[model samples]
Target: MTSPSTHHTTITSDPTVPLVRIVREFDAPAEKVFRAHTDPELVTRWLGPRGLEMRVEHYDCRTGGSYRYVQAENGEEYWFHGSFHEVRPSERIVQTFTFEGYPDAVALETLLLEDLGDGRTRLTTTSLVDSFEGRDAFVVSGMEVGVNEGYERLDELLAG
Candidate 1:
């Protein structure tokens, strides 16, 4: 039998500040979970909702490196790019994320991995945008569905 989803994703935002925080747990080790995030091939498999197809333009997971990718659905392509500011393998990643649709608005994102023992891991992510309005837009953009479903796919990847 498949195990229940131990994963959880939460989004918190306020009217006064532009930030979103997500916390999720995985039934795998921190190393495995972190690798899935940094590895371009693994990321393409689980970075979005199930129906979207992903194509990586370039991905470099080391410090000072950058990445760009596109997700296509029904012939519509969504572009995203980011620069890695800091990369500590299996522990933390700090990067700037931008969706090409909103060219001028970029968010600095930090992802931290914690080992929960027994081969479990917890991931905490914080995204800081330029304005509360931008942050609210993200929260209303059906982000939960993408985040939750993407993690579910990641779960399958880990299991395999």
Candidate 2:
């Protein structure tokens, strides 16, 4: 049986710039962690908060590939789409991320995975928006809750 994760997620944002950074450690290998992000089947298992159901429209996790998905809750669906700019398996992924709710604001997201040895991996993500206001809107939108809860669910998946 796997043990519960003891690591805490750290999130930081700069007031002067449109950036949000999140760091979390998982009790799994870097390749496994990266696969969880890239695999559409695994993605729906832990990509968002618990209350919403996710449907993948198209997910191709490779350089120059694009993806779109929707999260539905209470008959309301939220759309998100992005293009993969760079993909380095088990190391990094850079993509463009956009939410249909705020069609005008798009963010560039970079995700990195660091092998921690001892069968652990550290996942770091940075999101840069076009403006500080847009970044603030993301924070104000209860992003932390979704992030933390999602990772917690990821922990469960990893444990399993």
Candidate 3:
């Protein structure tokens, strides 16, 4: 959850499965929210934590497409790549995520956007990894910092 914002992201880990589930509500239309995730320019604006600079080397957000990007801070860079398995406009996305630091650990991620009416959208994401240890590592890796910050920035983008 965000520390000081009106909107919050609820991140939960499943005890029986190697999954991380995130739920959040945004005060924006589903189209806008979906665009922020699919558009390379909009994604670069708010995809990572506050300090790091994000660069999308290439982003083709469509079914059967793949993307790669890098985020850097203090001379250290983090690279991530993924393949889009399904892309339903303004509704759902299924993808595979891999961090270059742990090449063997890949997570299948699913994102769903539900229109809550009145220009609000509920976003839910689930990431399923290979093992419980991998899930635990992801939860302890300061991921909340990036997730919350990125959503906060997205809230700002939506409002602006």
Candidate 4:
């Protein structure tokens, strides 16, 4: 069995659910990267996974505010919503996430922005799911494509 620590994103058993992590870096400042996530207009531009378009239905990014968006893929819309738990400008954010298709499955995601001098930033997202099944579902949901592409779009956005 491969040790959990060896995985880039670990899948922990119940006892270790707290340590699962996912990290992604961006070639922009922490403030810009944080804005891409919290600004509805910017999110609508690049938040969807590959081949999909994201439509922001409602968004109020302040702490305790709620957000909703629909991702259209193959002519089908997948809805997602979450409420903000914490929001600290350019530093960190915590939110609760739930997908309409799997309403009961919820996850808490924390995003940490670390400034890497010279206009670069490191964004690490740690999502804690309610159960192992929830984590598996999230991993299998093709989120990687969307995430990577979104960052690419952000790069373009920053440059232009």
Candidate 5:
């Protein structure tokens, strides 16, 4: 028998600022979770929603580095690029994220991995956009589905 989603992903927005935060707890260590994010091949294995094919053009996930990738679904391609501003292995990363569909709306994003001990981790990410409207648009974009499903895939990767 299978259980409902026990590993919940909390997606919240700041009422006073143009920021969106995603928090999730995983049954894996911080190092493992961090590797799943930084390693390009592992990323391609589970970066977005299921049923999509992802191809990485360049994924240099290091300080001052950048990356670009394409995710295709049903003959449609979605492009996203980002530049890493800071990278602290197993701890935190700060980057700039841009979706090619709306090039002008770039966001500053930060990823934090907290060690919960006993082989567990807490991942927290915050994305800060330029305006409340931009943030609202992102919130309304049905991003939770992609994020929740992607994390489920990550759980499988970490388990295996």
Candidate 6:
């Protein structure tokens, strides 16, 4: 008999900032999963809170490229922009994220995509922030919930 493998995930908070780590297994190949991230059209279809309206103002997803977008929730709009630090096709990507309202609070994000065989893929995202205050603010602001929801939407998009 073989035991089912389980994957572990962790989210930690420090005095200055917090780190969010997520690992999700998807029923798709790595290439397809990777495309969902780098392709603006695909990303726009699934990258925001489920009920919020999102508009991609600018999207240059290659290495050294940048992106900007706005999410409107209940008539309130939030602006976010980021620059791609690195892009490795079908494997990994690194980027810097900043909210327009909180210009000084920048976060570093690393995304890794791994193939789990049998046409399954495991995608892990790690986000590191600058200070504990910023981390607290993010958690209090429901960023975790939003991120998880976004991933769930991605899962559905990929399934389609």
Off by over 4 Å in 3: 1-4
TM-score of each: 0.95, 0.96, 0.97, 0.85, 0.97, 0.87
lDDT of 2 by residue, 1-160 (tens): 4454588999999777899999999999999999999999999999988799999999999999999999999999999999999999999999999999998899999999999999999999999999988898898898988898889889998877
Candidate 6 total steric clashes: 4
| Predictions in order: lDDT | 0.91, 0.93, 0.95, 0.76, 0.93, 0.82
Candidate 1 per-residue lDDT over residues 7-109, each given as its tens digit: 6677677455688998888889999999999999999999988899999999999999999999999989999999999999999999999999998889999
1 versus 2: better TM-score goes to:
2
Per-residue lDDT of model 4, residues 1-160, tens digit only: 2111211322232446732466766668999989988899887876754578888889998898999889887889999999999999999999988889999987888889999999888887788887777776677686666655666666666555
lDDT of 5 by residue, 1-160 (tens): 2233569999999999999999999999999999998999999988989889999999999999999999999999999999999999999999999999999999999999999999999999999999999999998897898899899888888878
Clash pairs for candidate 4 = 49-146
Model 4 residue 94 CA deviation in Å: 0.5
Error of 4 at 151 (Å): 2.2
Candidate 2 backbone clash number: 0
| Weakest lDDT window of 10 consecutive positions for candidate 4 | 1-10
Candidate 5 vs candidate 6: the TM-score winner is 5
Which has the higher lDDT value, candidate number 3 or candidate number 5? 3
Candidate 1 wrongly placed segments (more than 4 Å): 1-4, 14-16
Best by lDDT: 3
Q: Candidate 5, residue 77: CA error in Å?
A: 0.3
Give me the runs in candidate 2 sitting further than 4 Å from their true place.
1-5
Better of 2 and 4 by lDDT: 2
Which residue pairs collide in model 5, if any? none
Candidate 6: worst-modelled 10 consecutive residues by lDDT: 1-10
Model 5, residue 144: C-alpha shift (Å): 0.6
User: Which residue pairs collide in model 3, if any?
Assistant: none
lDDT for position 20 in model 4? 44
Ranking of candidates on TM-score, top first: 3, 5, 2, 1, 6, 4
Q: Candidate 6 on 1-160: residue-level lDDT in tens?
A: 2222243334455444477666778778999999999988998888866888888999998999999999898889999999999999999999999999999999899999999999989988877887767767876787766776777777778877
